[model samples]
Every structure is written in C-alpha cells, then in structure tokens.
Target: MQNRQNQIEPEWTIIKILQWTTSYFKTNGIDSPRSTAEILLAHTLGFKRIDLYLRHDQPLNVGERNLFKSLIRRRISKEPVAYIVGSKEFWSLELVVSKDVLIPRPETECLVEEALLVLDKDKVSAPKRILELGTGSGAIILAMATQNPDQQYFASDISINALAVALNNARHLGLDEKIDLFCGSWVSPLKENNNLFDIIISNPPYIRRGDIKTLQPEINRFEPINALDGGEDGLACIKHIIKNAHKFLNKSGTLLLEIGYDQKKAVDEIIKETGRYAQASFRKDYSGFDRVVCAKKAYD
Candidate 1:
C-alpha cells in the first residue's frame, strides 16, 4: 500500500480534499470541522456554499489545487479563517480585518444591541452625536450608523494601522459621511473639543497580559496583542474609559461597554467610584455570561 504520509502528490480530488481537510481539522481539535472546511473551501474558490455544491464534482485547476494546498497548510498551523480571508462579518456587516485588529467577536454584538436600546429609550433624534472608542475596523460604529441613519458618529483608535482598516470599512459600507474617524487613544481626540456625545460605546482591550499567553494559538499568534492585553488585571482600558467617559458624555447620556466575562465586579466598582454615573448594570451575552455594562450619566 502507498504510504499516505510520505507521498508528495496524493492524487486527491476536490471532494476528497474537502473530506481530508475536514478530518484533519477534527483531529487537530477544531470545532465544527465540516462547516469550517466548507467555509474555507468556498472562500478559497471565491464562491458561496451553494456554488460548492454545484461544483462538487468539478476538477480543480492546477493553480486552484496549489492554492488550496497552501491554505490547508496554514489552517493546519492554526491560523484563523477570518485572517486567512481578510474579512469578517459582524452585526450583519462585512468588515475588513488584519493582524492589526482583533477579529470582531459575536459577543461584542451585545454592545451594539445595548446601545440601540439606550438610543431608543433616550429618544435621540437626527444628527445625534455618538462616539466609539477603539473603533477597530469600525465594526461597531458602522453597524450603529447603518442601523440609525440619523445619528452622527465619531470613532477613534490608538493604532494608526487599525484606523486605516476601520476607515476602509466605513468607506466600503457607504458610511463615510456619517462617521468622523480619528486616530488617537481613547477620548484623546475629543479632549481638545467641547463636544459631548449622546451615546458613547467601546469594546476596548480587556484581556489580562498573562492570560493572553493561554489563549488559543489563532488569537495569540495572529491578533495584535495591544488590542487584547488589558494590563495586569484586564481592567486597564475599562478603568480609563470609565474615568474619562463622563467628560465626553452629555448629561443623561449613556455609556455602553463590552467587558470580559469575569469583569463585572471590577467594572461595576469603577462606575460606582466615578460617582458620575447611575443605573450601572450589566447584561449577559447569548452565552448567558455577564458581557455588557451599561451606565448613564448622573442627572444633575
């Protein structure tokens, strides 16, 4: 019998490659191996899932076969599919992603949902001012402005590279006119101006430094550490925003934040210490973990 491991050209077909890749992924501890294989193959072919079905029996051209082999090698090395594809979907919007930005997580969608609820209750009208700190890929702000066309949005990020990615997404989504993009740390660009926002939202760095090493290889190896490391306790950025957000928030304005699952107590304490916010509370993610914290500026 031919040795499968030693053979250079294993005479694999497209359908066979899919089966092999799926099994390889499963053996490597990847969850949803079959779905991952389908998505990755579709992405490699520049086709949709249904299209894959249509061409399941089609033979891959030599160039296509080489490309699939390269991608499979990378996948075996534990690279994230989003990074390989150079884009990710968040809040139903396709956003460009790179090593400069953290891939937007589904959990962060909770921040968007909570922000919309606050806007609804506050009755915010047209030309509403909204600020998003650390707007990586502009996912959150773009999603918000797309949903609420009447709102005027502002976004800032500490990394210039991340800002570039975000600006591209905003332009691609036809939201450039609705958002003012800034390049700087959290709340820094807003400090020089007296502009207060009706709503402020952020999904800042909230992962502890030590814990980052323990994360999955796809995250630790590929994602920008600066965007994930939240200092020793994972509350560095959270505390900074909580301390500074009140200054940029309109009276009675709301602040929405995405927090680490174990960070509810620390974040709640920060809000309480600020003495500038009331009705501080947290909402759980779809996983039923406390993931979002919402607070409002104290009514004077």
Candidate 2:
C-alpha cells in the first residue's frame, strides 16, 4: 500500500495490481469490485478489458501505477465508473459521457429496441422522421439512426453541455450529419421546426425529487441533479412529454419513452388523460421491470 506516495512497488504486475485493487474496492464496499478494478486498470493502461488478461504478467511503471492509484481513490469516493472512464456502452455502441449528462444505462436500450421494432413493422416505404427529447450523449437517436440510416433524426436537450457531449458522440459515430441537434427543453425548440416526426422518443428524468438523494452515491453525487430529479412524483418530465409529444408527431406517429420501473401505471394514466393516443403499451427491460412506454397517435 503506497499511501500518499507516487510510486508503486516495482514488483507489482498487472495481475498483482488487479488483485490488490479488487480487494481494496471490496473492503471499501464498492459494487462489482473485480469488474471495477479491471475497468479502471484497463482505462489507465489504455487497453481493452480483455487486454488486461493478456498482459497479466506485465509490470506497471511508476506513472501507470500513480494514475491507477488516483482512479482507485476516486472510486473509493463513490464516483461512477462511467465518469471515471469517460464512456459507457449502450446498444453495443461505446458512447462518451460526462457529469453533464446521465450515463446511458442498459435498461434504456429497451427504449431503442422497442422503437426499432416499431419502425421495422411500419409499412411506410418512404424514409421516416424521428425526434428524441433529452438526448443525453445522443445514445438513443444515434443508435436508431445507425440501425435505420435513411430516417431524418433530430434530438433536443436542455443543457448545452449535454448537447456538446451528444454532438461529440454523434461525430465519432459518423451520424453527426444525419442527426439534427438542438439545445432546449423537450419540445420547445421543435415547435418552430414545422416537422411532424414519425417517431418521438425520450429517456427523460423520471426520479422523484425526494428520491434523488436516495439513489446510489455514484448517481446522486456525481451525475447531474437536473438529469435525475423528476419533480414531486417522478412523473413531471414524463407527463410533460406525453402531453406535448402528440403535437409534433404525425398522424399515427409513435412516441417511445424510457421510464422508471414503477412508473408504468402512472404513465399509462397520463397518456390516457391526454386523450392523444389511440393505443399505448409497456415493455419490460431485461430485469422484467416496466422500462419503456410506447404510445401511438390517432390517425384521425
């Protein structure tokens, strides 16, 4: 243990450091200690996680050890692994993330999956138009565009910094030219565009205000509060989107949303209250929790 020191013992190899870090993380009550250790170590060494095993016997020089030590300290402080490593994988595509945006979770991929399914089933021959609200890191829109490149895609976010991250991701994924990016709340900026989209989707903030503080420290402490707080009952953003989406969707257009697991019933009611959709349905994530809401506008 090199506390307040710049150098690790010269004999510390990749395997040795991983073992030590995993134990240290576990003792500190970090979740997925071994996986965290491997990710951080791989990030510090600029190698893929698989490469760590291939180079298990390689010794770390002083600089590499120092960097890994700093990352370990940050982890011990409960900073998220995604922020520390600066990326997360969603829909099998690696996306850039920061504290300015919510880290794309696996559950949200369910929204993308359902939206793609809807698009696939659509009998329309012409290219369809799509819009995504709160497009943090542009994960959903980018994934959708990648799968169906012919569609016109647009995304909006309230935070300019978040939009910047999304733009960076879009550029890296080579979908920048394909997706139009906007910086504004939900449908505000889209109102003047005069574009009625075939599909409207979002993964808005759905955590109740009171519950924000109760989340994991990695989320409550490190991720943006604005991206997590969903007002009094965790339905503020969801309600707003549900109410406004039909205005921008074409006749029979589909609206897809990634919502909190327990929000299905409430969101369903919100959809009904609007009297804007002809049909609405819910989909479960891999964990069998209600995660996405699919609502279709009335043709008449």
Candidate 3:
C-alpha cells in the first residue's frame, strides 16, 4: 500500500495515519486539523476520539482506511464535520443534523442559558409554557427540556424537512414527548392556539441575504439557504418574531433571542420601536460578543 509520503508501506498504523491526515488537513487549510483527523479516524474505526490515541499502534485494514479517506475527502471540500458524522453535540447532547437545518452552534447555548434563567425564576409558580421558533435540530427546546423538565415545551420551524430532523433528534434524546412540535413560520401555527407562553425563545436566521455567500464555505455552500437568509438587513426573522410574539406571550413574558454578534443595537431599536418589550438587554457569548437578547412583554 502507498503510505502518506507516497512510498510503499506494509501497514498504516493509527498514529501514522493521524500524523499524515493532520499534516494533509493543515496543508489544505482545514481548521483544527489534528482534532478533525482524530474525529474522522475514530468514526471510521468505530472508536472514541480518545480511543484513537490508546490504540495508536493498531493497524488500519484496507476497508477502514478507505472509509477514513472518503470522510477526509468530504471534509476537504468543506462539508461540516457534523453533517459528515450525522450528529453534533450541543449542550452536551448529540443531536441529529442535515443540510435541511442549520447545525446547532455553541453560541446558541447562550440562548439556552438565558432561557433557563427565566425558567428558574418562574419555577415557584405553576409550570410555565415555553415556545421556541426556528427550532432547528430541536437544540434549544431539547436542552431546556432536559434541564427544566417541568415546563411545557413547544417548538416551530418553517421548513418541514428541518422539523423532521428536529423531531428525530427529539425522539433520540427521549424529549419527543416533552416538546410539542409544529410546522409553520414563526408563530403562524400558534395564532389560533389559545395557549400563551411565559417564555418565547429563538435562534433565527439573522445572516444578511447578500452576506450569506461571505460566510465560511461550510455554512454558505452546504447549509440550507432558508435557514441562513435574513433578508436585506439580516433582521427579517428577528423583526417578525419581535412584532408577532406579543400575541402569544403572557403579560410580562420573556423573549430570548440569539442574535448576530453585531446586532445588539439594531435589535434593541426594533424592540423599542414596537413598544411591546421594555428593558431590552443582551448577554455575551464566551467570545464576549453580544449573542443573545432578552426582553419582557410590556404589561398594559
């Protein structure tokens, strides 16, 4: 067999393969090369990431090497690692994902954190009704349900295919029964429903439509366009949610939204313009960027 250096090799061992793949990924400008190499190799060998180091001396058979090679090729083309592996760990839960939905992001955990804070404060009363819009992969709702199981959970998505992925993830996480899934844009499906939520949350598409192509290739090329396009100013979804959420929120209900890093001012303005929410505020992500916005419905 040909080795990484293109010379003949009797066998390709785990350590050698990892070293080769890491160098190759680096040369190709792939991020986190060593970690990517380990993830792909571990997946191919049916081992955990740490297991790869433990079995460093183990030899990869032809079949295993071929599978690893295929994954590497896909990665080199900029397909997301989550899509390649078919799952992503968000809030410590492995969620199913696809091109139909935006991959669950770590920054979105800020939204979950804010949501949990709201839920915690309301726990002394009866179970609070909670709703999440654009619930891709059910990440936010599921994470909240996992932590605060006493609340009533509901989630909606515009894309049926995206909802399917979220539903499957919910089932996998055993949260299917906990969250009621709906298919429609924003709060459309809930317009006729009598239930008013104590908390409404979302991590909507906020990328400017024209700026979608400017994002990283893994996002611009591979992820769903509908899940990324945020119209001319990247606030279409945000505006819609802010304007319509009042109809579904109980008096003084909280709205928590994950926003673009630079959107604090604009979103703050939108919330103020509607005169529906007061004390519009923001929470920063680990990177110190304003990643989540919080506001409460203005009581009449």
Where model 2 places Cα greater than 4 Å from the true spot, the runs are 1-8
Give the 10-residue window scoring lowest on summed lDDT in candidate 1. 1-10
All-Cα superposition RMSD per candidate: 3.3, 2.8, 2.5
Q: Kindly give the number of clashing pairs for every candidate.
A: 0, 0, 0
Stretches of candidate 1 above 4 Å error? 1-13, 124-126
What ranking emerges by lDDT with the best candidate at the front?
A: 2, 3, 1
Model 1 lDDT tens row, 212-283: 999999999999999999999999999999998889888788899999999999899999998999969899
Q: Top lDDT: which candidate number?
A: 2
lDDT of 2 at 34: 99
Question: In candidate 3, what are the lDDT values of residues 1-300, reduced to their tens digit?
Answer: 436644434358999999999999999999999999999998898899999889888888778888999999999999999999998999999888998988988898888998888877775668899999988888899999999898899999988988999999988988889999998888887753486998999988899999988899999999999888889999999999999898889989999999998999999999999998887989999999999999999997
lDDT of 1: 0.87
Off by over 4 Å in 3: 1-10
Residue pairs with clashing backbones, model 3: none
Backbone clash total for model 1 is 0
lDDT of 2 by residue, 113-231 (tens): 99999999987789999999999899999999999999999999999999999999999999999999988988887653387999999999999999988889989999999988899
